[model samples]
Target: MEPAANVLDLNQLRRSCSSCALYELCLPAGIGVDDLDRLDATVKDKRALDRGDMLYREGDPFEALYVVRSGALKTFVQNEAGDVQILGFHLPGEILGFDALATNLHVSQAEALERSSICELPYAKLQQVTSEVPALHRQLMRVISREVVEEHRHLVMMGRQQAQEQLASFLRSLADRYQRLHRDGSALNLPMSRYDIANYLGLVVETVSRLFSRMEEMGVLQVNRKSVRILRPELLAALCRSDAAPRRKDAG
Candidate 1:
């Protein structure tokens, strides 16, 4: 067993992590260099997973809070019928296992969508660190708040949007997230397959394929297999706006 106090090196991790787009968000709102060093000292372990690897299964005992160091993860719950309902896609800088904080059992399984890395902060040590460091508490609060907002957005998407609108919204949101990760927002290299995307958007795989074809035909985007280039982002945005009026109504 690894020693409880085996912490990652602060300066080395920071230096390696400086180029990542998530660095600013991963640290607290007002964290300085010295504070970051302290926070880094608390990270107990780092692990990497390949695409299609499972990080944790549902019902596993939750022991640590995980922060995505790079790549993406899909978190989902399995129903009694064994159908999977994707909860969310976690990008780098995002934290996982919070839902289990109160109950101690993981509510969903976290699966890697691509080659990914994560930093594990042991829950006991994390609690101690938060007690000692005000910034860490603030950072955790911010993470929780963001999750709430994202959940609300997902609810709205599922409740209100049509299938096409939902698909467009998902793609646009993905582009924005990709941009935040310092990747090309306009050009997307989809890590998830059409089936995965279909499941996530609550649509059939055929519907997802059709929507992609339609978007391409409308000159809104160019698609080839898993790669997409947004040709007309404004038009794509319009397609995503289910509440917006038709062109004639807007003209009037």
Candidate 2:
């Protein structure tokens, strides 16, 4: 006898949660098919953005959460003087816009650092589905908790006085995130500009440039514009923990 006609269709599966690359990271483990279907229904089609495109500006009404489907985005806030402070850089497979959940108004602007695409989940629809899906509700809570933990970590990183340690930590964190995506941790293609990075790290652009050059000289990393290759992971890790400032050969 031939296989049943009710067999699964590859094309149909590709359009659902089963084929999403972020399925494991974005959804609950061992979720039932019915729950997955309901959750999937909340996700709108992927929306594309160009470099410098603003996804949502500060004070925009909170209506949806976005999952980075490709490329990168940066969230930032500008003071009255119009000086922009970058809050964070987002990568593919990561969810963003959680900051607005508390006040129902965005506190920062989200802009595409490069050409990007994202999947939007309307907050109302997401709530409706998640309420009916216990596992999904639990997963959403876990995601929110993880975001809080990461924000705290960023605050701690910013408090470190040494620029060397700050830069090192930033690189290490990026590498770790890449590793989690099952990609090459040693290599990174940064989507944000040096200015944005300096702003986010609370360092001057000149300082960030000098640090990158110094790290390259030390064989800790190789940098070419936005592309970086971490040559010595151990050395980078050491820098993250080191309290001493980088020494210059001309200091003698």
Model 1 score (lDDT): 0.80
Model 2 local distance difference test score: 0.87
Estimate, for each residue in 1-252, the C-alpha lDDT of model 1 and write its tens digit: 633446765545444433345777676666666666566667765789999999898899989988898888999999999999898988888899887877899989999999998888888878887877788788789889989888898888877546778778888998898887777999988878898888887778887888888788889899999899999989889887876513322111
Distance from true location, Cα of 237 in model 1, Å: 1.4
Q: Write the per-residue lDDT of candidate 2 for residues 41-107, one digit (tens) a residue.
A: 7888778999999999999999999988779999989988998988899988788999899899999
Evaluated with lDDT, which candidate comes out highest? 2
- Model 1 residue 250 lDDT? 16
Q: Looking at model 1, which ten-residue stretch has the lowest summed lDDT? A: 243-252
Off by over 4 Å in 1: 1-11, 14-21, 244-252
Query: Cα RMSD to native, each candidate?
Result: 5.9, 3.3
Clashing pairs in 2: none
